[model samples]
Target chain A: MIPNTKTDPVIDVRDLKKVYHIGEIEVPALRGVNIQVQRGEVVAIMGPSGSGKSTLMNMIGCLDSPSDGVYILDGLQVSDLRDDELAEVRNKKIGFVFQKYNLLPRVSALENVELPMHYSDENSHMQQRATDALKAVGLEDRMRHKPNELSGGQQQRVAIARAIVNEPAIILADEPTGNLDSQAGKEIIDLLLGLNRERGTTLIIVTHDPDVSAAAQRVIHLRDGLIVGEGESR
Target chain B: MKLLQVLREAIRSINSNRTRSFLTILGIIIGVAAVIALMAAGQGAQASITGQIQSIGTNLIYVMPGNQLTTATNRRPLTLADSRALANKLRAPHIRNVAPVITDNNDVSYGKESLQTTVYGVEPGFEIVQNLSLSDGAFFTRAEIDSRASVVVLGPALADHIIGKHEGIIGMVVRINDYPFRVIGVTTSKGGSQFNNPDTFAYIPLTSMQARVKQDLSSGRVNYILLQAEDEESVKLAIDEAALVLRENHRLNLRQPDDFSITNQEDFLSIASSITGVLTIFLAGIAGISLLVGGIGIMNIMLVSVTERTSEIGLRKALGARKLDIMLQFLSESAMLSLIGGILGILIGWGLASLIGFVAAQSGTDLIPVVGWDAILLATLFSTAVGLFFGWYPASRAANLQPVEALRYE
Candidate 1:
């Protein structure tokens, strides 16, 4: 267990191991991974399929738990956290986007973006924050369109807008542009970079694309559940 | 604004699956409508019967034997002697009026339209004792009955068939039991009675009917005894006195129990009301079971909806929807479905009830179904309750779903 200290990283990882037990067989998803990220950093974790990158992203995003690990995220030990507390942590401190552009299809883009604010304790003004988030993603003009009515790129932008509407300390995207074309994907990466540079929002993208890795300042490459490369990009 | 948005979302969700939503509500509609229609029918029947019983008069009592007591058959047929014995024993304080009745089924020749009727033989006081109306001509007097008069009074239906809707001829002849009897008067129509047709009957004086139409009264038997009291308040006393006199004359121990069932208006009304009430509720209860099935229909559809919108649920949860928000949204949707269905059901049920009332009036029953506001309110409240009951589980399941897993659902 990592002792509670003043110098805890925003995400502190040490010997994180994730095991999946299906019936009698145990599949090791993440084997003894250790990493740390300070505040306000754009870090891309890159690896091919089945390299445990998605599993690591799940642990980092507080979406699941590791079988054997001590994951201290934003100074709170998150690995053994209960469901509600995990949800609270996810609600208050982490924002998520996915490649499929998972905005609710029935609601307008604005409602989808403002929904996360309903979970937060911040009662100042949800509307202004929602508008600001949309403005930040540069899709404020099409706020009234439902996901089905919006193009793939616009939908992805709306999802990113929803992820940041709560003003979480970190933004996590797993294949955020995986469903979009090159132009749409580049626009999404540029939007993430712009948010990182302007608001100093810590950005973590999980992808296997070279373009996605190149857009980040640091690329952590993994192979077969082990980190094969970690260095500043050229 | 928040409420409007929630409602809009709910409406859109329902609109997205119009076929399924409408199909689910069909069950609720039928259940509620059936409940209303069945209850209305029971009420209408009970009301019509009660009206008939009241219209005849409360003071009259029919003492028919052989049905209530099989053992009392050999004792004696209810006889004119018994009626006279009671009349003689009955004083001013005991009873006001008493009349012995002699009735038999006979064919009446009304022009060419000869119909079978149960003819009644009544005394002079029997007209007032039973509240039989006199429309055209007066009833038979004591002299006419005592002199073994051949005069008879035709009921409205018999009169219509005989006189060809012409003005009544007070002194006319109609044959009864192959004997010609003078028509002294015509009684007003008492309408159709469910038990027997009062309209097809012809009335004659008791003594005249005894000698000619029934010629066998020497065996000492009559059909019924009609009684009347001095006032409405003294009817109970008259009843008790009549019971005592009959029991004493029949030589029965009062402790043995009454062989003849004495029914008054109060007893009749109470029995009828209770039967109608219980029958209506039983019918309503069966309809309520169908409503529950309808509620289950809502639940099953909502569950399917949750599964269909797995990605949407995940997206909403990820967007910071608390468990309660999602729950309220779905609950509102389900409640809307049922409440709307309930309204339609009430309208249909009320229309059906009114249609029944119209048909009854056409048949001269004059009974209306009790489609009171209370019934409508109750149906609406119950349907909404069904909505809530069925909607709770699916709403909770949707609320409690994990956002990540939902989003990950393909």
Candidate 2:
């Protein structure tokens, strides 16, 4: 694990902008957003609907390139990377946990965790590593169970295990507890926070819940594709 | 991603919707099966017809009255005198023998049984020129032909229908067109085709037929002349010699064309083969149309699959799958479906061909459908190409999807 230091931030963004063209109309999804986060910091991004938080998460996840920006993820400039190269960056350096716990429906929990490794270049001991990751999420006994076969909390745990299985530098979780009950959501939040504390893994959570935002070390509120406020959480 | 992994994913996805996948590939199956079975039938028909033609002596030629290719007004009937001229050993040295035939249909009866059958009036040379063999007694002699005796040699099938048996019926007298004639022999059975069957005819002296049946012995004209060459190598020489003798007998000058046409066994074989070849191609072309429809079916199914798996594509993309990976995944799925269909179609088509052969054999036709390895290879290659070609558009659409928009799709 890399030690947390103020000298170098794991994620750096300056004046990032994204505009989507819908026929003849230019729709601005992101407008001059700047953000920087240290290694291992748990940051929560809160916003209402139509605020472009999803677009921001897409940019950070390297799923889409920004229209204009100077963005660096883990010391590599990714704002100008092509689609395939961005995919490689996402495969090696970033992991994603969707709101619906987007584990492949038909595959087993262990196989779901192994998905990221399939895209990565690490071809050795993949099954063993997947099994170990499932054990870390406290669902080793349900490793062979599919996503639908597990409970909401268990499915989210499997999704977390999948995100961290590749040992990524940053875990981008979009409303990871949005589909679960309060108790299951708290269990998911605890599991994600535990992962950050134990592995020095960076966490970026996009959410509308105050409880989720309050649990983070820092919260950044977004409005109309720009950061409205930033503060340290209690 | 590993190729094996991609294929495994494709198989898994196909298995998830087994019924739809099978239905989608049904078009391919029917198309391939039709192609194989129809081609087999065509080849079988050609083989059967050609085999029958070859069974007739290869060195034989036919001289028919009038130019068969032209619509000329002036026509002359071929006479026994022209046949005799062609038969002269000195002038037509290549011709081994010549038979002048006078044919007429008559009702023959033996006791209570009666049937309308063709009566072929031919000279004694016909037995040798036509390669006829007797199953019972002997053919009518040259003396009987000269004396115009009422001795008849029945074909095997004709004797069976009238006398109910070939043995001991040689001395029986059958009434031909109400005139009594003694049956001397019955020729051996020669498997017949739809066009020509010699087994249903009766043979007698040409003089007897002209005097009794026709009642017009003035012209002494014959229907056709069958000429046998000394060997296969002399067939062309024999045709030329017979034509020259016939033209001389008919008094045609150098500037005028002869009023007759000549054809050999090779011409018959080639004509039969060409007809069957065209039939085979026509059948295969129709089957190919069905295969094209099947390809369209695959495209339709693939498009539906791409739309249904939109979120799955988004999930894979989010998990860092490249555009090529998604494209290959769908492409392999469609390819796998068509490959399986092609193999199944081949098995069914082979069984169908064998069944056709079996049915044909049961009905006394010696036709065996041939399913060549080349046909199977062609079908396999074509089906795979169809899968790939039809799979291209849907796969590209899936690959072009934006991950965020796809994930947001309900």
Candidate 3:
């Protein structure tokens, strides 16, 4: 292995492999993949069913580690990171927006957004920043509504509000519009694009929908845990 | 990191599962209440016995003739000369009261209802040693005692036996040995002193009981001697003086064994106290086992709750809750349940103990029930520790769960 270059990207993955072995059977989720997304790039990974898209999304989200390669997210090599360090990277660097809008059922929209900020190093005036994040997502009018009471689009917006509130460098949205109908999905994608355009925050979306891929500036297609093609957005 | 917030979350869990929480605490309540009420009742019983003994005149001392029911007669019975000698010649502080009594079984016939009664021949000062104040009528004077007159001072039980009412029973006559005897006095209803019944027999003059009932006995034959010292501290002086008088009267040397056993009220009360004390400890120790079972019940429920809320725990962990935060939350919930139950148990124990005391006092029984402060403290502390000990393992298990596996738990 040669010395890594000095001008490193925000997320750099080099020949990463993740294998799932159960007894005698071997399941390879990622087969020697190489990818890099520099700062301020809205990148999307597209793949069909059983194409290891969710597995790649999990690895990039820092929820799981690559089987045998280097993963440097925000200049820290995360392939060999311990549990606490992985948790620290997840907390301080990459923010997540799931498709199901995993806002806590009992807490309100503002509290759901405020939850992540509470765990961060941003100590003073946390409430004001949380409110600002909610207002930015255009859900300030529905601040007190619990996730159960909110519509699909509103819940996704609350999730987005939670993600960007921590001031993280990367926003990872894994099929963030999958649970909603087309109209609600359009609203969520529009919100995500607005965040990318306004804040210059790097965006990564793993989705099967071609229209979702078409929204991104750069789209990479995956098949059998390896990138088959890459093209610019129309 | 914030303890108050952790506690608040535990409290919220309690409120969310109201019926389940109440059921969990129920076991603890019954266990703690039983221990508190039983131990307190035992202590109160001991105190009541001591009080009965003291009321029988604290300055009193008793002399018994034999060690057993058989004829082990190294101890000699008191004689009239010994009583006369002690009562007349003893100094003031050492002897406040002295009486010689001769007792024998006799049949008293009152119409068709003839009952065998133990007739005790005693003088006026006999009331002081036995702690008897009459409810009605007057006791036989010194003259009646000396003249061998046929007069009787009835105990409460005997009065009920021979006559029906306290009203005008003083002048009524009852036959003893086919000789008419006037009822001179009726005794107050006194309970057993040092666990011995005080109201079982009637009192007669020594001269009369000897002449009518114990005729084979000579003029000097007295079965027992009762002495009452001035105070508790003066018992030693009184015992010493009485022993000297008995020695001189029997003409004994130091080589010979002592004639009688002398027992004071304090010795009797102490003996009673230790017996009850051991019994109370044993009862509380056994009842403590129930509290342990209750703790296991809490642990079982908490473990079930952790399993039930597997997804919820995952969500909480994913939402950035630390391990210790989750642990403290569950531990606080369990502690809250048992401690609250313990408080209610203490209250229930107190109420039951008080009712028991009230009922026993009303029924003319010697039993008394009370809640001791130490018992209450021990019960509360024990129940709380049960919560902590049994609650810890499940709480730690819940907190140590992997978020990924818990999220996937079906």
Best by DockQ: 2
Question: Candidate 3 residues B252-280, lDDT tens each?
Answer: 68776666667787788888889988998
Question: Where does model 3 exceed 4 Å of error?
Answer: A1-7, A12-37, A45-89, A117-129, A164-166, A196-202, A217-234, B29-54, B57-103, B177-180, B191-197, B207-212, B215-297, B343-380
List model 1 lDDT by residue over B168-196, tens digit each.
Answer: 66777778888888888878777775457
Worst 10 residues of 3 chain A by lDDT: A1-10
Question: Lowest lDDT 10-mer window, candidate 3 chain B?
Answer: B65-74
What C-alpha lDDT do the candidate models reach, one value each?
0.80, 0.89, 0.79
Candidate 1's DockQ is 0.34
Is 1 or 2 the stronger prediction by lDDT? 2
Rank candidates by TM-score, best first.
Answer: 1, 2, 3
In candidate 3, which residue pairs get closer than 3 Å at backbone N, Cα or C atoms, i.e. clash?
A: none
Q: Say which docking band candidate 1 falls in.
A: acceptable
Compute fnat per model: 0.30, 0.58, 0.08
| TM-scores for every predicted model | 0.83, 0.83, 0.80
Could you tell me the interface RMSD of model 3? 2.7
* TM-score of model 2 (CA atoms): 0.83
* Candidate of highest lDDT: 2
Please give the range of 10 consecutive residues that has the lowest summed lDDT in model 2 chain B: B191-200
